[model samples]
Target chain A: MTTATQVEKEFILNMGPQHPSTHGVLRVILKLDGERVVKAIPEIGYLHTGIEKTMEDKLYYKAIPCTDRMDYLAPMSNNLGFSLTVEKLMDIEVPEKVKWARVILAELTRLNSHLFWLGTHALDLGAMSMLLYALRERESIVDIYEACGGQRMMTSYIRIGGLAKDLPADFDKKVRHVLKLLPEKIKEYETLLNSNQIFINRTRGVAVISAEDAINLSLSGPMLRGCGIRHDLRKANPYSGYENFDFEIPIGKNGDAYDRYLLRVEEMKQSLSIIQQGIDGMPEGPYRAHVPGVVLPPKEDVLYKMEAMIFHFKIITEGFKSPFGAVYQAIESPKGEIGFYISSDGTNKPNRVRVRPPSFLNLQSLSKLVEGSLVSDVVCAIGSIDIVLGEVDR
Target chain B: MEHNLNEIEEKILDFLEDKFSGSIISRDKFRGDWSFFIKPNDITLFCKGFLNNYELDIKYLSDMTSVDWFDHEEEKKGRFEVVYNFYSLKNKIRFFLKARLPAENPEIDSITNYFASADWMEREIFDLMGIKFKGHPDLRKILTPDDLEGHPLRRDYPLTWEQPVFTWNKDDPPEVIK
Candidate 1:
């Protein structure tokens, strides 16, 4: 054999467009010298569905359902962003009840997304039982989605003008049940992972980035906050009545995977507080806005009244026209800042609909995260980012 | 209450007018948000100006995308418009910068040198919208296969167009789905 100094040590390794740890179809090309990664180039687009192009062809309100399919984990957050952008473009002020109800739904979605992330991330790090525990808690949230939107994952319940329909009869009871149960389960998860030796070894100081680099890379959500940057859009720029609620934005000291894990766990508690505030301070008003010929009328009214029936026929046949302008609206989605930029040409269909996906931005920092770490740390870093490939390749 | 411009708006207008007055094509406020249309040549400098300025520290590049304004009714600058959305974390304000490029060879200087986040966003605009980003180091297609024919997001590209599949058995007829 040749001497160690004269040998060719560097080699190429392809880590997946199909691996389960990637969370979706994300392929990373790694240049390795022994076990240390010299350079990691991420190759995406295996899940490309051309969603932005498809959205341009559909009517304004009809495109709401398409948003659900992108970030399938937190569909309500996507729906909220798209609807807020279109509502701003059209200059429609939804009722007070709608805002409070939306806050409730959006916060619930944050809990749902974070739970799934915690489960899958822990499982990736060899904590096998966390997956079962986390998913068991997730089922209750899925039940709420089905009770409200009739679909578990693709719940396009939050419509343009307002919600798809009023809250279900037992919506209050079901939400209250989740609210009471999750706080204890969250504490239990902390007890399991906080003291575990394997998790701390893999996560702490694994992928560290400073606050300045995090901002320079344009990271958001927990990614930015984990770097000790206090940048939550809900507090920085409030929307959908998020200003009225009171909650803490948990931040991390070090920009490593372990800090991110702790920050997200604290965020679950904060989400619960926001949900509690929403349920306590909910106001009474119309479920949907009263913009005739634009917003869909109530089913009972459409069946009985002539004007409601005529308006329904018009809205179904040809969607209402929007003003000629553009608007950019962003929300503090569970992943990060998911925004929608819509340009209308005074037509029923939007001129351009561009989604500023949070996962796409967060995924860009992978090369930096796994710069000189071992190949196994790549899995830890990717799981930490919590990327949904559907949104990344959209 | 809505008639008066906010403090941040006044300050941004004053700064832009003071620093780079001649480059601005038009500035408008729609639904309480401000957007500026500037010349393509001045985009890199304008981004530099925003980043270097102490008061208007608009460091974060939220998004960069293009709109194909084909057969539009409203008055616009050119055939293709590249929009950049920037947010100032310090000032807590948003600034929208836009530049127009011709349809034949739409091109603009990439701001990746100024902001590292501009790398992937610029590549995406190149890959999907077919607008070239000059000086982007690795401008390969991000979301599409390498052998694809044309940009899918262009308005001229048919929505339902499908790519022909390659097969080993060239003698067999290609299967078609209506």
Candidate 2:
């Protein structure tokens, strides 16, 4: 007969409700097996602002600004996704010029997001010098965003029927300057990490998820493509005139943290190609659609013309109604396919709006990857996953 | 990419045949999005068959959420309606499964075993809606603190949070945020 052994010596550790490493108000309950993670449970919601429920009451047009703060890094992507869904339901079309400009700006937004990811991902892996170099270039992208839309981060420039306004005259010059400089900067990052034995050893085989497992986990964007799934939403189901642009989807043969990093670097190159194409073959037409009720008139026209003033006032105070239907529009954001699932019941306010954010989905596989791995490698795996807790917790 | 939604509905009904008696499910297809209602008890079985037997292969559980039934309070329509969003990697289609549960006691089977992604998602729904998930390996408040009292996202719950909004433009006037 064998007596039962008591395991009362174990202790639970509270990692964070506010630790810098936990990444954005994320709390993790860590049950330790002497310095090893026995069970890692992520606790969130310290930043739950109830934005989804808040969207239920606000008018559809008012909700555009709300989506920006959800994933602050990829605000334009969120704006584009939401606007595309609204346009799909309304069945309204913007001018060819507006469409192309949207594509260009959205791609630029992708650059901003990817640069931040690169800097932060490397910084998390203890490459602090790389972060400063990456952010130096990232500041220029933010300057472009501000110059084009008059605001940084929360642009809210991508409207339902069209853009908030036309692209600035200097937009092309600025984009071209960044385009010329970005390749060299990217190569600098690659040279620092690509051949470095330490970085390669920490990331090359760490958090290696197979292609089938990545698909099962519903990981999208570079994470899925890094695993060789070749599932780029932009290439597969293009929206916002992405089908018209020409660009290659870079896929990694190895499914690891290093592959994900390489895939993102290659994707930035592809994004530059698409933007250049969009600008070169850009069509000439009006910037905004002809839907007066749905979209706001230009500021000049609103101030000068009586008709434009009334239209703008009505839209600002009492939003327009959308047709009774819903559409799920997913765009290939830098992190992954950022999808907007919108439902309207023929009201000024939306009946339902659910964001299928890819970061949230990609973060699902953390346990699957980190379970058996060394505790020290958890940060590298998380950085490789490239999750934005703002979007994830949202 | 396109199929007769009515025919699909008929097929589903015929497939599930009177096993769930008087389960007159109302399915509404808006645009291309498909949504069907199911009883709380039958949701687990229906979802199982919907994924496996029907070749939907919606192995990816995208998201799970819930809404309070306060608008339908007069109809005594219980309390909450849990919504599930699934994307079938095989067919490239998405489906919305809604289960209406009693407000008095909202309970449903755990789909985590079927879709591992549902592990955290179900916890989120439970944290926000207070809907209990039976057989969930470790169901707890996901997006909220463990010591938190109520589900703060309910209709009755106020959105007037205590956090202050930071503004870079000092000239900007303060707006009353409801």
Top model number, lDDT = 1
Q: Give the TM-score of candidate 1.
A: 0.96
Native contacts recovered by model 1? 0.73
What's model 1's overall lDDT?
A: 0.89
Q: Identify the runs in model 2 with alpha carbons over 4 angstroms from their true place.
A: A1-14, A324-326, B1-24, B50-56, B72-79, B161-178
Interface CA RMSD of each prediction in angstroms: 6.3, 7.6
Clashing pairs in 2: A45-B143
TM-score to native of every candidate shown: 0.96, 0.87
Model 1, residue B80: C-alpha shift (Å): 0.7
lDDT of model 1 at residue A12? 72
Per-residue C-alpha lDDT of model 2 across residues A17-50, encoded as one tens digit per residue: 5765556765555555555666565556667666
lDDT by residue (tens digit), candidate 1, A192-305:
999899999999999888888888899999999998988899988889998898899999999999999999999999999999999888899888998898889977789999
Please report how far candidate 1 places residue A103 from its true position, in Å. Answer: 0.4
